[model samples]
Target chain A: METGPIKQKLEQQWQDLSLQLRAIPINPLERKWATIALLIAALFIGIIMIDALVHGINAPSNVETIDSARLHLSEEFAEDNLGVQTDGSGLITVRMVAGRYSFFPKHIDVPAETPVTFRWVSLDVLHGVHIPMTNMSTMIVPGYVAQVTTTFPKPGDYPVLCNEYCGLGHNHMWSNISVIAKEDWAAPVKSAIAGGPENE
Target chain B: MNDAAVRKLALGHLWVAFGAFILACFMGEYQVLERSGLIDALESSSVYFASVSTHGVLMAFVLTTFFIMGFGYYIATTSLKQPLWNQPLAWGGFWVAVAGVVLAAIPLLTGNASVLYTFYPPIQAHVVFYIGATLLIVGSWVWCLIMIVMFSRWKQANPGQPVPLAMFATTANALLWLWTSAGVALEVLFQLIPLALGWIDSIDPGLARTLFAWTLHPIVYFWLIPAYTAFYVFVPKQAGGFLFSDEVARAAFIILVVFGLPIGFHHLYMDPEQAAGWKLLHGFGTFVVSLPTFVTGFTVIASLEIAGRLRGGKGLFGWIGSLPWTNSMVLAVILSLLMLIFGGFGGLVNASYAMNAMVHNTAWVPGHFHLIFAGTTVIMYFAVAYYLWPILLKKPLFSREMALVQLWTWFIGMTILTTPWHILGLLGQPRRISSVVYNNLLTLSWDPYELAMIVGGLVLLGSACLFIYNLAKTQLSPVQDGFVQEIEYAEPLHAVTSLPEYLNDFKLWNKVIAVLMFISFGVPILQFFFIDTFGSSAWGY
Candidate 1:
């Protein structure tokens, strides 16, 4: 297993290669290319940073935790308390529960041209809710509450779809949200809140 | 070198990888067809989900782990010109991983563990799935151990010498895996396993996701590095050119491993558990990781440019056409790079902290990964297989024409499959669903894309079959007498007599990774424990 000649040949090849390379003038192309590549990456990061700062298009960061098993028992997410509620300060908050196959308080009514904060909790498995054509999307992890606040300027019926796979019926796990005119929304809210037979 | 033992080991691992791959390809086509709702009898949620889960596991875990392990072993032995450090241990690892895949498959195929590949908790899988996946990681860890040891042994033998670029890249991947797998290993052993076994009455889904995210992103790099290694080590020589720069290739690998970690929070950008600051931080890091890929694209193309010019090419774009396209390795690299450009653009969108909210967990996510992982990464795996089959078996390829067609079809199929997928994401299609039963205008728009995907999937399946058929025929053919061919690694035009220790060794980079990981992940993971968080009881089977 004497490898002296093989090793010598490898060393010779290295020496010859080095000599040949050194004889040729150094190419500044790779160095310039590396710099340009780094700049492109930096440019992307800068744009993202600017977007985050300017548009406030950040992630859902409210790290609020609730017990999944005890969610129904909680004061905020109780069966009777779920759906669109207008607080004293005119803050419209929609509290909903995402369970195995459906979102509780299935049919939701809200007003357009007003800020509505969505507070979402999962009673069982993980589910994600998204309203297409709007900045309303968040994951409803069982133990954590996902909250997103947005204003819908246009009045339309949007499908509240569960994007995350929960179980076999995941595709069917969806509800509907109707965004009505501010003047027209008050009547429906009253009817919707008045012990409407729960969609549970 | 008369290395029959190593050849057998490499061949064994590669066969298993390709085996899982072909099976997954069939499942992939079925999924598209089922999701499209084009056929009535093919609609079963239970079966669809079970198939999706199996397809994901087979492609992501089984195929990648076995392929990287096999490729690593072959690279280590051939590049270093030494036998495997521990042949028996390698065999043991192979069996362990095989057993793990089999054990995991029982639950996955039986519809007991249809949690998708992520296995995010609260939506729990069967306990056997977690245990089996752990064994697979453990088996890969053994391969990692062997690679690192071989690397060190070579370094010791040839003091201050620049290790072979192929071996260096392989060792980098080995180190990267050891660090990368730690996250999922911790999650599985501490959380998923305990919860699955009912030893823990309640588990934090937030914590589970956090830890899984830690493994999720870097694992992509773990898979990609082998492809990048081929791009550097094999492609240039196959294209008939010298490596543009050896030092830069090493630098690219180092940057990938170090920066690839600590950036997993990008995956958690839209989740509630982590804060926007951490996501932004990881987002910046994600962009930083893209630099290596850019550098790789530049270096490899430059190599090809040199190759093309030598073959009498002129004009700015003339080099592209002049390079050898019939050679499988050369053809695969060209196609792989083309996919990488598109996939890398998709990645930029995914990593943009603000833009990510628009596409997170949508049809876009799958579209992005399929382009990158199945498109760019796996195509090179095909190339490497085509290149190695002849050398290891001492038999010429049965059909070079078939290999070229397979490579072209894979690229076209992937493009066709992923393009509409990205479009569907923009149209607000949710991923991982058994079907689109919404029957709305938006959902209706998704139908055309779904139809296109089926066509794409069919093409890909055909291409995959052709790839396997070529390899099988090559291996089954009689070994030619006096057929001797050695593995050829590309030589750098500018080789060095002496190199900085940092470029040649992993000691410093390992420490750097530790510090970076601490900074990026420390608060995100630790916050889970320090906060007043409630755990969720297991829900799904």
Candidate 2:
């Protein structure tokens, strides 16, 4: 081929390639359906998530009554004498005075597989009781007792936090919760916060 | 100064904006990773908190405030077909504002102020922090005054002619901001500063929160009105279509400014500062503001439909495809609207008086805000920068393909970052946490989403770098492609050559605002003097 004809042939080939790449047609109905499906899926996913996270998917345990569960939580964490695990496991009691707080048996020597309940009441601003391990949570207000019940599935150290955005030091006000093995709670265990008279 | 000088002025503003944006991008990536808690090296609470605060202030405060003031001056001059009335004062405002940002950055970068952007206190920062922030807002107030004056002067000089749509919207924003910033200005000057400096014995937190609430809701409109102005005035012309309705556009601006006020209590819904009745009144007002959004939506979409129809598309929604997808402005609107739907829905849930309990103070708030502010509003800012910079600089874009890529990545990255954030929020994960120290089921459930966010952040960071690179090249390119394009505004469909004094005016709007503020806030605010209420003890000092 002559030089001019060769240049024309290359130009024609590039045009064919451009047309092929740019000509991919999109279907309208398919696109609409895809958007609709994605939206519906997002909605369903949101519902399932909230159902699992907030309202929760699993039903509240097969325990007989809410009243009974409240009682267990209330007695275990009261500031007065509380129901201890008879297996020599210590009990914890918490009280709020004005805006200050004091705890009885702040560090509990609780046995493994034993369920501990927190009975909390706020004297001032609203407070939330949250234990992240077992997802146990409740809210406490002035004169209104709120309780949370959870079993220590493992012997480890965990923090119990006040999740509410209360005044200040909200982050620093958390306390420690230690889970002891069944054998340790049966005997005497060293406590982080000793049950001393001066602490009161 | 000549037109060349004005062009240089506009270019400088855009250059600073892109510079701040790229720094913000890297900070964003670092944040997502630090918050994720997967990598030990990237985990530093001090750095994370400081970075988050600085990133938010830069993007939300510095970037938007400076960009808006600069663009407003230019738009006011060009759209009204006049020179800036007070150039020296405008430049003075610029310097003062820039100085404030530098002062604020000293404490922020050094970790003296880690108030995590929102600065809702009891959480005290250095006194210089509060002072710096005050100066920034004060500088903007000067710009706002200048704008309102220019609008008034323009109307005086050229009466009976329809003042351009762009100038009208800019003036509306200036007036809206004047009313809007006063709330926070009073709060900061009176309460926050005194509290931070130990001058006040006890701050009335209820009043402070209420004042902040007054400024809270409408600030979004301050960011949004500019974006909407571009949508109505610039995008239509760029898409090769006429504006659907000039009157409807003006009505939307009026409604946004008027109803945008008196709806501040939605932020106070959870606070005891405002009573239930007042909050409800504000709640109802919040719902009313959504009406103008719908009005804008219909008008803009209807305008797009006309463009599509004229371009030979048939059917109701078929016109969506007929839109000029290759055009950056049109593409940006499509993406912006997509984000608005998701973010707006999140806002609906947030605004739902009853449902607010579900996600209150959760990660959802940040997620919703980031999507709306960053994805929806800032992306449109990008579109504006792209459109304006070329004309203002008298140079062709260095890379159109790169701009499109950057915009797409930004949208995708925002979705990735925020979707997980909202889910985590709903799952009971709190916001403003430096890290998750516990290895528990609930915290563990957040791991996957946090990882996604980190990845998304990286993508966004890369995209940000690309954006700055493109703009930099366009400005400093060796190839001098001389392209001089004057600003072309969208013409109203009905061709409103002449307008009534009331229709093409803010004089009536100003009077209406005076009466509205008196009726809505007069008694409620005055009640503080008469009522016997306890105040909060000085907790900050």
Candidate 3:
């Protein structure tokens, strides 16, 4: 046979080979199984979200814009309002600034059974406060405010660490929170600081 | 096509890729040791950060880009039986990429540029680093352009024939890379380069991060596509079976490229730039992308099962034992899929909006990525290297047994390293730390895991060395007489004489990607420009 004809025959054989490789139709039962798997996953996610919202054990909400450079000057994050602030109604809001290597207001004291709003912003780079043993975490991005409100059920110590890498001192970037009983909590000097809504 | 010339060109690229890979493996071992806080003398934050930056760039950018390009060239030529459209341009692209690697190395090695992998801003690197990165990406873009052109030419010449599965997947990746890299490319050109050059006073980090997020997630898929291509096109044949489904493979690639582009906002779930609604949307898209992976797993496993049964094995799972485990290709896939299962589960957790809080930016993040990228993806790269090394060099592998040992060790080492890493994340150990000096009870609990990681890193380093030695020996060994092997593509169970335009071609899918991207990202990105956002000054050296 001539080279041209032989090459053509081989090409035809290759092309014809596909006929044997056709996909077999999947059983309806398999489709049903797939649907069930998807539904279970969706249901799990739904329950998690509902639980988070109902219990207020989630990322902070109502993020407002902020001047990262002027954070120390901002009324909400002023040195005076740095730690725990309680309004007349005894509701607590924790005001803090997360900078390189440290979270301002190193010791955060929040009253248990009180919905304390944790509002923070990054002075330089991005940081994240992950409260261990709780579902409360939020990013501290520069030029924007991060807010989360949750009430701890009992009084205990919860170590807050910066999850996001900021700089050289990232490993040392951590703070402690001493959650005391609501009955032992003291009143705040600056009531309802930042002049926003007093309570959620 | 000049076969000798193409082989030379492909080998050159692969050598460069493997060279960077071996060097980075050494650096990786040192990193684990230093970070374990066990070696006090090795603990320098600057050195650790610099090593990390270089290691990340070499592995993530250098190794993956070179390997993908080289593999693409070989695939396009061998599968299509056509010459690489522009050989000189391909060589030029290779040189440009090498030069970029060299230029980037200067700062990364000297501790001048220590921005770890991600394009998070304010923590700036040297101007040379950004410029070099641009050049590297630009070179890859040239490869992209060439692949698309070759794909179009092939379709034009052969009117109705189904494109070979390998070539189709390669061309799909080229298209995906083109779409995906534009996000980071724009960021570098406009935001980073200017900031580094002192032209811009500051940058809106939110915008920078949003743009990088566009590239971050899809880039993993870009690295992964070649591995997946091997799974679909080569694994069945090597396992002594036909491909289970060609159409399903094509569909998987289509969903991967189309859905992968617009869903990167999942990476920005914790970031402040994008809203929760957009994150949720991307989160859903992330789940949708997982469908292709499921299809791939089922198809690959079924193909292996068919191979095993045809070899006289019986029962559902017994056929797995009948598989040619000595074959590097077969062994790699089984291990790759095992890693993918764990890695993929970790991905789902990361993609979940609420559940992300538990593991985000923790040790779990690195553990998950290393399993997927190194375990699943790079293991396949090794298989491809082993399979192709002999063909390219026109010699049998120097040591098949060594290759098998290397694969096993790699799989074992990765498990040892990442399992503990995952546990550490759950134990509240954060990632990106140089060391933990002030050891208390909680920090002290991490010691055993850290030691395990050190041992794991050492084993992987040894395996990496073995792989390089084997490839080098194969290339340098004297050619055997009558040693001739032609590339063999796996035939599908049913031959496809014809395919729909969307199935055989990417034109339809490209348009689909454009619309989906606009819907997903257009508003989120434009909102940044419309809103009055403050810019943060560069903070890091």
Best by lDDT: 1
- Model 1: CAPRI class: acceptable
The interface root mean square deviation of candidate 1 comes to 2.8
Stretches > 4 Å off in candidate 2: A1-200, B479-481, B500-502, B518-541
lDDT of 2 at B217: 86
Candidate 1 residue pairs that clash? none
Index of the highest-DockQ prediction: 1
Fnat for every candidate: 0.72, 0.01, 0.29
Candidate 3 lDDT tens digits, A1-200: 57999999979966664543343344354355446656755765576566455744443434357889987688777666677776677667788889887787777677788777778888898788876656557777788888777768888877788887677677788877878998997665565433433311
Q: How well is candidate 3 docked (DockQ)?
A: 0.24
**Worst ten-residue run, lDDT, model 2 chain B?**
B532-541
Q: Candidates' DockQ values? A: 0.42, 0.03, 0.24
In angstroms, the error of model 3 at B180 is 0.7
lDDT of 1 by residue, B200-311 (tens): 9888889889999899999999999999999999998999999998888988999999999989998888788888888888888998899899889989999999999999
- Alpha carbon deviation, residue A198, candidate 1 (Å): 7.0
Give the distance in Å from residue B435's predicted Cα in candidate 2 to where it truly belongs.
Answer: 0.9
Better of 2 and 3 by lDDT: 3
Kindly list the per-residue Cα lDDT of model 2 for residues B439-501, writing each as its tens digit: 445567888989988877877787778878888888787655656778889987777676555
Q: DockQ of candidate 1?
A: 0.42
lDDT of 3: 0.85
